[model samples]
Target: MSEHQRAMLNHIREVNQHIENLVTDYWKAYSGIDTWQFWLNAVLLIIPLVFLLIYIDRRRVFQILFFGYTIHVLMNYLDITAVLKGLMYHPYSLLPMPQSHLTLDASLIPVAFMLTYQLGYNRRINQYLLAVVIGAVMSFIFGPIVHAIGFLKMYHWMSYWVLFIGDIIEYIIAYWLTSFFFHFYRNDEPTS
Candidate 1:
């Protein structure tokens, strides 16, 4: 390999090592079965996920699951970017991983959006309006409560408005993509 390529590889290795160290330290300091924060994180992650699994529309399961998964992936990506940029972070976590807010990213937020999407689909409500309402509640109500409880912390010009706007955009994108894919694939099937 070229010298430049070798140097880049070394730099990548160094960065990975640093990330491993940081995660180790964080886990040691905050994550454990005995910790209240860990239990709280578990509860936050599991309850919504269970409810979604149990109550999601069985007939429309594929559509709702696709939408929810899209939301989860986008939110987690944005959240990881925010953490890397020092915009926000979680101090405690249920699991030892780089993204400390897995409970919120993987479960709570996604499940909430899933249920909202299902409701909007079933009732023929305007999805965009529902997104707005969900975003507002997440920003004004859930955000404050989580912040007050010390589950989330913002820094360096980050605020609840950023979270709200990001969520709204995510919802729109997920809804659009899921609708497109479902319609595209379903169109290929022969109508009886």
Candidate 2:
């Protein structure tokens, strides 16, 4: 074989070996799942996501959680219904919760989106405008791509707008609540 072919073969072999190791480690971790570990792992993952928000701004703790919860409750409701209708599914979940993906969808992503909006702009008009753009991208682009990638699976829905509507509605409500709470109560103000 030529020198080029030899190097290509070596690279492919290395990639395959790495993939094998990852799969083995995954199976080992999942071989015997424990009830506590399920929740624990989720807690562990959530800690860092929270830290990201705090790192962005320490004052916004209550605003973040409450706004996130707003999205969480609504999205989880849809998730349960979707699962029952075979409109959505997850192949894996740490928790046996009705909707395993609730943590990210409801708590993390939407919160982050709103936070990013506010962080970049202090005025209401800018925040709302940015939110709509973010929401549309989330619903139209990211949502369908995730569904195609099997992180999300949808059934009985081909319009793609279904996911888009969910994202748009979610961001609107979550952003609205977070914004109102902050404007009226200034929940994000850091305590003395």
| lDDT of candidate 2 over 25-72, digit per residue (tens) | 553464215534345446645864776665655565676667667876
Candidate 2 lands at a TM-score of 0.60
**Cα lDDT, all candidates:** 0.91, 0.62
Clashing pairs in 1: none
Evaluated at residue 16, the lDDT of candidate 2 is: 67
Worst 10 residues of 2 by lDDT: 31-40
Please report the candidate that would top lDDT against the real structure: 1
Compose the digit string of candidate 1's lDDT tens values, residues 1-192: 999999999999999889878887877776767778889999999999899989999999999999999999999899999999999988778777766678998899999999999999999999999999999999889999999988899999999999999999999999999999999979998999
lDDT of 1: 0.91
RMSD of 1: 1.5
Q: What's each prediction's TM-score?
A: 0.93, 0.60
Error of 2 at 106 (Å): 4.6
